[model samples]
Target: MSGRDFTERDIHMALDGELPGEDRAGYEAWLAANPDMQARRTRYAGDAEALRSAFAGVLDEPVPARLTRAALGEKPVVVERRRPRWWLAAAAALLLAVGGAGGYVAASLGGGSHDDSAQDQLAEEAIAAHVVYAAEKRHAVEVPASDLDHMETWLSNRIGMKLVAPNLSDDGFQLVGGRLLPAGGHRAAMLLYEDAEGNRISLFVTTEPAAHGKGIYAQSGEGPRAVYWLDKGYGCAVVGSLPDNRLSEVAKRAYEQLIAGMIS
Candidate 1:
């Protein structure tokens, strides 16, 4: 009935509504008395909800034959990336939605589909980051925009590029800040922005060679809609819940500013 009596598993159980009824009151009381623990619980609950809301329909979608074959240890059909390939996005979604089993299948299908898989991962990571951080109130970013120069420099050095937070006031989104994240074996930088209505958008950038793709590609139906592209050795995606046209416009402006900055 006290903090000392509870374990980490208890916190997860409480958050998942799986705790015993007799212990619920004690857990709630303990959480109220521990603000830090309460904050952690809130963040975890938010992340879980975000992931659920983002991929709730993944289970209902029919599995692609290629993925199924790959899962069964058969070589997957190599698909060309002419247009925006949705199946790879779906595969990434499945990997996130189903956990270990999906991971095994993804590992099985990895080597042969390097390029499309890499792009899929970028889209997945971008959307996943947006879903997790955009919903946060207190910890939306690692660095605040007030220290824009410092943030840019720090991210640039970490991500191995001259990272610049694109100006998007014209799109009604002001720079909130940015954060550094791990992207497979590489480093990634993500800048967060929010409009007057408090709607947030995130731009995810990485230096992965495979992330270099043909043109601006749209990834949807997994989480939020994202416009991903590769330019100047940097792969980037602008992710938000905005309409397709609006998201594309913001992404285009961002891409232009980013490219111009690199050139200058």
Candidate 2:
């Protein structure tokens, strides 16, 4: 904590309250000198709050009988035992929530759209949009599929990330159109696509700078299977009723095209 400049490691330590008393003052001083990092600190604070809210109810849920039996081990039960599976799941969710400073998935293990974190909310919104629009007889999208170029250019500007409407024709799907939605207190883009059978899928993209580090993650919610990933300062999820394997394949192809565009 002396001589060398404060590192991101130090900031994380200070935020987590793991910094020692001797080093704490120095870290705080460093943070005070750098206004830009205040945003990062704020995010950490918000992540802590979100984690608390998401997991608070787990304590009150009834413990599974199997878990209680495991703890009791044939002994006559005296006090109530906790659910082993639930504890493990809660621990994982906590790790997800704080691990990325709240930009990544902190999804509820239950089949619900109320997880309330950035990535969780994005995936939920994506699935919700897809379900609502996919059933449309008409007016499935705000922008028509014919205006692919304008949709790409306009959305790229509004969301502050380069956009590409990945063509899914090889997989028997084509772009239907896209629209803007709200995510993480900012604008997110939702692109819809359809196959010959009229089965629809949606791609939701948002600005999430501190999302999952260096890889993609997939989650199945109540409605659809969503494969999500963060790349080049943005996060996106592909939501559909396709089998998990098929969804993964589509997500992989879309991811490749996006990365290629970024590289080019």
Candidate 3:
């Protein structure tokens, strides 16, 4: 298949060395000519390395008491007083996998279909939240641009993560405002931006999963295609009624700026 025809799944399989011989050759040829794909591959490889570093040690350790009890179908005698460090390490690995690539292929391979479904649900919910809030007239955001600092601080605290407003003026989109919305079990910050044409795009940010599963880039009842990405430790979804290419362009611009601002 041509590079343009490759699905996110194809890319993931290719990266994980699971593609068949011919498909693997095609992907390699495509990568040879596609710098963006190459960069994505590099990032995916880096995420794999991070995962190995974070959790490879856990494989050698005795299974945690809670895990052993759960595996044995026996209720633990005493409630585990503390969460195991392995869980935290695994979470970190998940964050890197989602943020860098798309999501964890290994997790999905291990029968974490629920996680994949959750990501799709997240995209849908984010789009619905965008449609509901972007139409507001008097109060689109909880804190207006006048209280930018307060808005950022309030959102950061509520989301349990720092927040940075993305600059979209160069692309003719101005920050209208932002508000907190419920997403998956965490509070997500939805920032609205509008262009001169009155077209609105919502940037949904949450710290729950960097990437949960393969995200959908599609047009649906909620609105136009939404481009989602995980950067640092945040899950970012950009939704608008714009065309797919336009939405991708805007998402890429926003992603670069947000990553730069947040990382630096």
Top TM-score prediction, candidate number:
1
- Candidate 1 regions exceeding 4 Å error are 1-114, 214-222
User: Local distance difference test, per candidate?
Assistant: 0.75, 0.68, 0.69
Q: What is candidate 1's TM-score against the reference?
A: 0.57
Q: Which ten residues in a row have the lowest lDDT in candidate 1?
A: 100-109
lDDT of 1 by residue, 171-192 (tens): 9999999999876556799999
Error of 1 at 206 (Å): 0.7
- Candidate 3, residues 1-264: lDDT per residue as tens digits? 534456557668976778877677677777777888888888988998898899888779986666666688874352223324454354444434444443322233243433434455456667888878888888778888778888888988998877788888888999888899876556799989999999999888887544444333443234555567543456778888876556656776877777776656
Write down the TM-score of every candidate. 0.57, 0.54, 0.54
What ordering of candidates by lDDT runs from best to worst?
Answer: 1, 3, 2
The whole-model C-alpha lDDT of candidate 1 against the native structure comes to 0.75
Which sections of candidate 3 miss by over 4 Å? 1-115, 210-215, 219-222
Cα miss at 44, model 3 (Å)?
A: 67
Model 3's alpha-carbon lDDT is 0.69
| Candidate 1 displacement at residue 172 in angstroms | 0.4
Best by lDDT: 1
> After TM-score superposition, what is the CA distance of residue 151 in candidate 2 from its true location, in Å?
0.9
